[model samples]
Target: MPAYQLYVYEDQEKREALEQKICEQVDACTEVNGKIRNRVKKFLIEEGITDISEMNAALRVRYEGYLERNETVHVPITCLRGFDRIFLHRMKEELKTLAGQRKYTTEYRDQWLCLTHYPDVEVAESFLTSKDGKELVWNFTLECPRKLKMQIFTVLKEVIHTYEGWTRKEKLLALQRLYQFCVVNQVSDIETMTLEEEQKFALKLSEDLGEKKKNAVFGILRMSRKILFLQAPEINWNANVWFLERFHFSKERINPSKPVELVSFKEVTNLENQKILQKYLRYLFGITDLCISTIRIKLLELRTFLVYFNGEEKPIYEVEAEKIQRYLESIQRQDTREKTANGRIFMILQFYNFLVVKRYLKKIPFRYEYYLQKEVHVHNDRSVPEGVYTEILSKLAEFPEHLRLMFLHLWCTGIRGSEVCTLTGDGYEEKDGDYWLKVYQVKMKTYKRIPIPEALYKLVQVYKKKYQIGPEEYLFQNQTGGAFRYGTFRYQMLKYCEKYQIANGEYIFKSHDYRHNLATLYYDSGISLQAVRDYLGHEYEEMTRQYVDYMPKKLEKASEAYFQEETHSFAAELMKGEFHG
Candidate 1:
């Protein structure tokens, strides 16, 4: 058999009365029919009672009546004392409305009693204890102790007297006057007052305190206290003082007789030794305030000078070269592992050559030969073979809409992922009757444009509509609707591939693969190498040839057809015999 159910909407005070009525109705073995049933049903109907879903008498009688003969029904009751009756009534009405709207029947049962949804508990308590529920409780109960009755009478009298004594505007003026009087009397510390004193003070202040004056007084007091703390002698010992000290400068003596000269590094041996020395000093001192690229460039220059000093025709002695090597080795060993020791050494060697060949430094060192030989081993690892382009493209097709668009943009255009990430609406332009996305290559500091595809254009239109893409908003915002981070995008791509079971092949599908794919596809389609280079926005044709060589079948065919030995020999013979001089 299905479970018994009951449904009722009653305010807190009425809840107990209703429950008692239900119990009496059940105990009396009342036969609900004809005139009696009609009277009860009419009362229920007038009270807007509909289906007995939560508590159904008929269902309860059929299923749990036998249990009722041996047991008692228990329903927990919580008295919402001092709560607003009108609010509770409205809450009941809302629940009923919801029940009616959903067409709930006798099959389900649920109950709730909500007081208020105010965020602050204190405010909710204050509103609950206000005059709103007083009359509703009074109507149902008259028996009370004389003291309670007298308390109620006094409260009502005070409220009525206050209301009748002054208009709202006059009360506001009185509040301002009272607040001013309190301020003059130095009684602003409300905490010092007893509860009764506070009540009296509040009543008096309510009549005279102006909202603006109260706010101004509070603001002035708060600011004055803050300023006093700020001006204290101990403020110099605060954390902020140390932070500001970072920017402070000690007085330096100026050489008034000799003016400082501005000269290019190129003019001074085509190298800035002082800048290199500063970078080395910063690195040694663990200072990271300098730009990474600037530090790298300076390090490279220092290495070049060291290499030149060591690798001159008149080589530096073994002792001197060992000293230089030890200094560099010490830096390498200091709290950091070198990922590419060979690369570091190669840079050092290159810098040495620049110093020597540029006539900035002199001598080849015999001890440096061992380091050079050791560096060659680091370069022996074979480069990974390019992964299948088709596999990457297929996987990219299944990417989420936004990422798919990004991949498509990358694939069609040979632009780097970083460049694509920084692409904005401002980069798009109508160039020679074609819509193109302009990208500035950060590494190269060069600008180029890629034509937009029809599909991509449509996708962007929908994206703009959904995101309400403003003129200044990033095209690809993250989940929280902010610009996508490069690290986040890369992490997402890896996770996506892993979930989809894409093979981790020789070449991982990095952002640069898109450039490779674009170049390979265009080259294989019989486009001229020079034209392909121009399309991919490569500054040099030699770089484009790298992609051309990757497509060995196409390269072999072009070599056989255009540069055959027979063709070359015939052309040479014809040139030798052709002139009718």
Candidate 2:
């Protein structure tokens, strides 16, 4: 390391002369500027820093140290600022004359230095300026072998190019920790890292980092092994998960509440089983009309079933009806819900059907209906309680403007939460005096237009105008300018409801509940069942009936209307007997 020059003067006469010069510089400034300078001068004289050195950089550093150690240091920040303005700036020319024209010295940072040791010079140069590289601490990778360093850099390059925000930062941190572990263990090849070494690294991380941080690091590493090392034959970390975005699902226009991101087959450790599952997924995603979300659920259910039979020596093709019965019994022993259990069995049956079509299996293993539990479709009261919604409306001003408007959409229209999230600016239309809002129902896979409150329509127009939203843009959007996530909306609404103590802090906000509320309200207002069904975007009136709650009032109203009529046979006889018999 090159030593920085210290210009501390030992002679008193030279120190006094330099102090006088600094004082003279202060005197030339106005009173406001001179106040802080005067403090710096007084501080220097008190410290007996009558040392003048050609290296002003070194001199300033020494002065800073004195300021820190001194107990009675007054306005140190101001004094430091004054030191730079007067000593460094005003006296720069004089100092340069004393030590020739070398005003600033170069100090090589470890980050820049590590580049020389990197295997690929051009890659290092490009990476040095990349987003991930700019923030990396080079000390962790300094002693790692060329191949290991190259692997780390490659992963980082992919991470920088692929991800963004805190996700990118987190993956970078995960890689850095991995690099440090590699360097310490003298492991040169990350691709050939052993399972034992992987376990050791995880244990070390858990000890050094807390449980949460360690888990996060391991999660990122697992994801990187799947994503960044796609062509690599093997990696130490066992991650049989794959991100769905790589398959171009975006083109399909399927954006679900919980994004269909990764599918994990880690439970099914058999490589042949994994390949079979992958082929099934590819078939579902490509050939079938099934929604991506539906496909994801099927994949999860299949993974569980495969995990159950993982210990078996036989391949999935050779599984007989007897084994299938055992698997069914094992699942039945668990405390799974009837509906969920039935769904799981149904998915397995579907998978078997797919296998038969592809010639992987000679025939289906067992009768699907025999294993399935009878599922009763009992509808729960999902409507938001009157007290809860009324309370929300009472203090609606307290919530954000956007949220308040979104609530109105749910309150006024019996639309789904997903439809509310994906409302576009041009979805609103005015015909003569009536206002109508058009929304695409993701579930029904169609657009539905219904009359909306004039006030609500105008409010939306005003909001769009205020936000400068274009016709093609979503009425409500996330930070990324895409349609706002329904999950995020629900989460934020619940947070605020709890904060403001809505329903005495006991009520959890559910967006779907508002849909039910609107449906019930429409039914109670004497709207035809067919009209309510249409408004709710339901395929059948029977399905819409499930959404209608508070049915007792509607039933009571119907009974009262029936007896009031005198012309009806039973009602007329009762009226005649009471009045003239």
lDDT of 1: 0.44
- The TM-score of candidate 1 is 0.38
Show where candidate 1 strays beyond 4 Å. Answer: 1-319, 322-398, 430-433, 478-483, 503-507, 549-553, 561-581
Candidate 1 per-residue C-alpha lDDT over 67-124 given as tens digits, one digit per residue, 9 for 90 to 100: 3342342310111221122223223344457554354221212221121312223332
Per-prediction TM-score = 0.38, 0.66
TM-score of 2: 0.66
Q: For residue 469, what is the lDDT in candidate 2?
A: 92
Residue 147 in candidate 2, Cα distance off native in Å: 9.7
